[model samples]
Target: SSRYGEDLGKQDALGNLIRELARTDGIEWVRVMYTYPTHISDSFLDAIAAEPKAVNYLDMPLQHASQNVLKLMKRGGNRKSLERLIERVRERVPGIAVRTTFITGFPGETEEDFQELMSFIKNVEFDRVGVFTYSDEEGTPAYELPNKVPHRTAARRRTALMKEQSRISKRRNRKRIGEVVRVLFEGESKESELLWQGRMETQAPDIDGCVLINDVPEELLPAEGDFVNVEITEAHEYDLIGRIVLV
Candidate 1:
């Protein structure tokens, strides 16, 4: 099924699909990605929350928060609506790791619009964020628009937004310290072969951060792809340090 499954007259296809997938045997995890904000219904959130196999992680791309910018981008929702949507998502699926992306420097975007976006990032404090600089593509509706944002300005805004998200990410990860969580062991870390790596349910494979295994009991060596419980000993901006508690 599509990431954000379609809604028939009376059926929520995506939510039903997730629930059905969760019921299947030998399927330990069902992770979804890139769900559009507008299409995330309560049923969808419920499917994720109620199904033990469905990972509580959402990757929604909210292109821009400013009302004007969003309108120009042909995405309808404004900051207030987006905020309400987030509130609903969090309320429905507690502790769900919400990941999102934003676009900066869209055509006709003003300084005020960019500031509004910056404030949105600070207020939302998403678990993971990605920002892109708007670039003109030939034959697109945006290409012929007036008052274009210079490439340099777009790049600068992307960097500033990322920095703010980094601060928020660090604080969020710090809260995970001392928490015992299930991790999918994935063998040696690229940083060092001496260390091992794994991903928490909240961490989406390679795109998100990882749990760096600093200590493992001699007898409980988990082969790659094994699910193990790890006790978080330390937290960095994007990674957690942990030792195997159960294998």
Candidate 2:
């Protein structure tokens, strides 16, 4: 929820929770999701970096990058500030996969605002990115706001942003090639039974990309829900190809 850490004097409650959960017997991975940018403290990053059980991943959705549009939407933050935050995050937690989402064509979102958003995406090479077109809701302030953007324009902006992000996403995935990583086996792939699938630590069970297992040793096979080390041999825009590296 957006109100994470709002209670408990706004302390690093999430960080504390991660540490506590890590001590549990059967919990192998502690992954956090939907953390708001405003409350990501250094202590939180420290917990993630220090705890081996804590996955090196952060899911913070920055709804928009344009200060003007953000203010209009009541979610305030400019590109410069966000860039600094991301820089700090990376410095605090090495090898972290940062994931974010954005909205396009918000009310009063001028072409300049969209361009600023585009520039932000290019400047910050996030590990994963998602985009959405703005839609109005009843009884909401945005629905009654002036200078509402047209549907076609909002959709166009969403497409353009996603297209640019696709290149960045592919580049991000390509970096993982040749890395030996542990993956949680999930049995046969949806695309084909001969191909198996699993998720790396950076990829959430459903919200992110997965590692597709195309080869396996005849004598050794990983059962569903088992942890196995895979040697990543190939990377795609949204998936990875790897062979089981463990016997």
Candidate 3:
């Protein structure tokens, strides 16, 4: 579940609601997205670690990693703090997939700042990442900032960041091969009707990668929303190929 613009972990009421939903027997997976870095509390991490139904994944958007750029954006955390938080999260929840987003070419962002962000990505090695170019939104604090980055430069930076992430994603996905994972069947694969599409616990619906199920027995085929175990056989840049493992 995503709480856009608001940090769910900071709000006790919403966090409790999510915890309750995660503990529900019928809910196969509970994913959290768009959590602010500074506001992620210990209670939130504890609940995620303890809940069996809570998917071990998080989407935390850290706009930029460079201290100068982060300060300009008023994002309330430095590179060191973010690194520490990520480490803590991983330590608290083993095998958790951490997804994050970054912005490129923000106002006053120097070449060194961009490189610093790239270095941060390499160091963090996030399980999933997305990078976007800064847009000049009128009436926003950023719009009035000096030294706005050129559109061309911003676009180029976005491409570079995504390229780096593609490599990271492929390497990460490849490690999943040979593992048996529970997949939540979504529907038929978009590429072919003969194949089915599903997502593992690490993969959030729509935003993350999927498992393409092949060679399923007619009688054992799973319905939509059914959780079935699949043995991963192949891994692509963003998706995995697997066949249903009939018990």
Cα lDDT of model 2 overall? 0.89
| Candidates sorted by lDDT, best first | 1, 2, 3
- What TM-score would each prediction reach against the true structure? 0.96, 0.96, 0.92
Provide the RMSD of all predictions against the true structure, rounded to 1 decimal: 1.6, 1.4, 2.6
lDDT of 1 by residue, 1-247 (tens): 3344334455678888899999999898998888887788888899999999999899888988999999888888999999999999999999999998998889999999999999998998999998999988999999989999998999999999999999999999999998999999999998998899999889998789999998999989989999999999998889999999863
TM-score for model 1? 0.96
Clash-forming residue pairs, model 1 = none
Clash tally, candidates in order = 0, 0, 0
By the lDDT metric, which is better: model 2 or model 3? 2
Question: What do the candidate models score in CA lDDT, each in turn?
Answer: 0.90, 0.89, 0.85
Off by over 4 Å in 1: 1-10
lDDT score at residue 26, model 1, on the 0-100 scale: 88
Flag regions of model 3 displaced more than 4 Å: 1-15
Model 2 clash tally, residue pairs: 0
